[model samples]
Target: MKDSSHPQATPPHPAEDVLDHLGYRLKRAHAALRGAMDQALREHGLTVPQYACLEVLAARPGLSNAELARATFVTRQSMNVVLRGLQDAGLLTRPATVEAGRARPASLTDEGRRRLNAAQGAVYAIEARMIETIPGERLSRLLEELDGMARALKD
Candidate 1:
């Protein structure tokens, strides 16, 4: 029994503590990764989202705005702003007239490829640094676990 006037301070449960919370740890890791990528991308005048769009466009060739929005985990309006910036910088292109649907499919330009190539080295280095922090034997498991977690939560 505890007194109502002066309640005892409860000891923290290790598993239930905020420091051990999965969501908190995930958010912290995400922020660290984003910050690192942002720093690496700043020299090239690119934001993390812009670089993500470029990377996706490079791999997929021609993706509609909405498709890109989904792939990048951004709103269509936000993606439009990113696309406009990239287009203005001559890093990507869209058809002057929509020949098929309302969505404008975007493709990387020669400059876009060049820029992506330039940034890839730095980005890969950052990834390598992160991977090096984990044990070699656990790397695959870590990746699989992350993918599984994401899949489980996606509804």
Candidate 2:
């Protein structure tokens, strides 16, 4: 049916008690993590988005802006800006002209690798702190449930 092509988006109903809502708790955790990351990345002169792009590029080189944007949970436009800033900082490289299509592949330079490696310690420390807060046995189940929640929302 033609109606199948146009699915309606339904907003989630909020719980009566905001404090007891899963969304509230998840957002609080996210905000806390982001604040910590902001402080940690600031010491190394990188924003969270910038650091995310570098980390993703280091792991998988020669990814285009659109690909990087998807992998880093950012928009393609935002990724372009992040890539340009990194390139200007001598942390990464993008071709002057596209060798083929519109997508110009991006890769981290030696300095980018060095910077990411340095920033990893602080980032990892933050993760370690979070891990310590949760019970050891529950961590895996927590991750699984979080993944399930994300998948559910996507559907």
Which pairs clash (backbone N, Cα, C closer than 3 Å) in model 1? none
TM-score of each: 0.88, 0.87
lDDT of 2 by residue, 1-155 (tens): 45877895553665666576788889999999999999999999999999999999888999999999999889999988999899999999988888579998988899999999999999999989999989999999999999999999998
> What shift in Å separates residue 75 of candidate 2 from its native position after superposition?
1.1
- Residues 1-155, model 1: lDDT tens digits: 76899976664445667677677888998888899999999988899889999999999988988999999999999999999999999999998889777988899999999999999888999999889999999999999999999999896
Model 2 worst lDDT run, 10 consecutive residues: 9-18
Model 2 stretches with alpha carbons more than 4 Å out: 1-16
Candidate 2: the clashing residue pairs are none
lDDT of model 2, residue 23: 84
Total clashes, candidate 1? 0
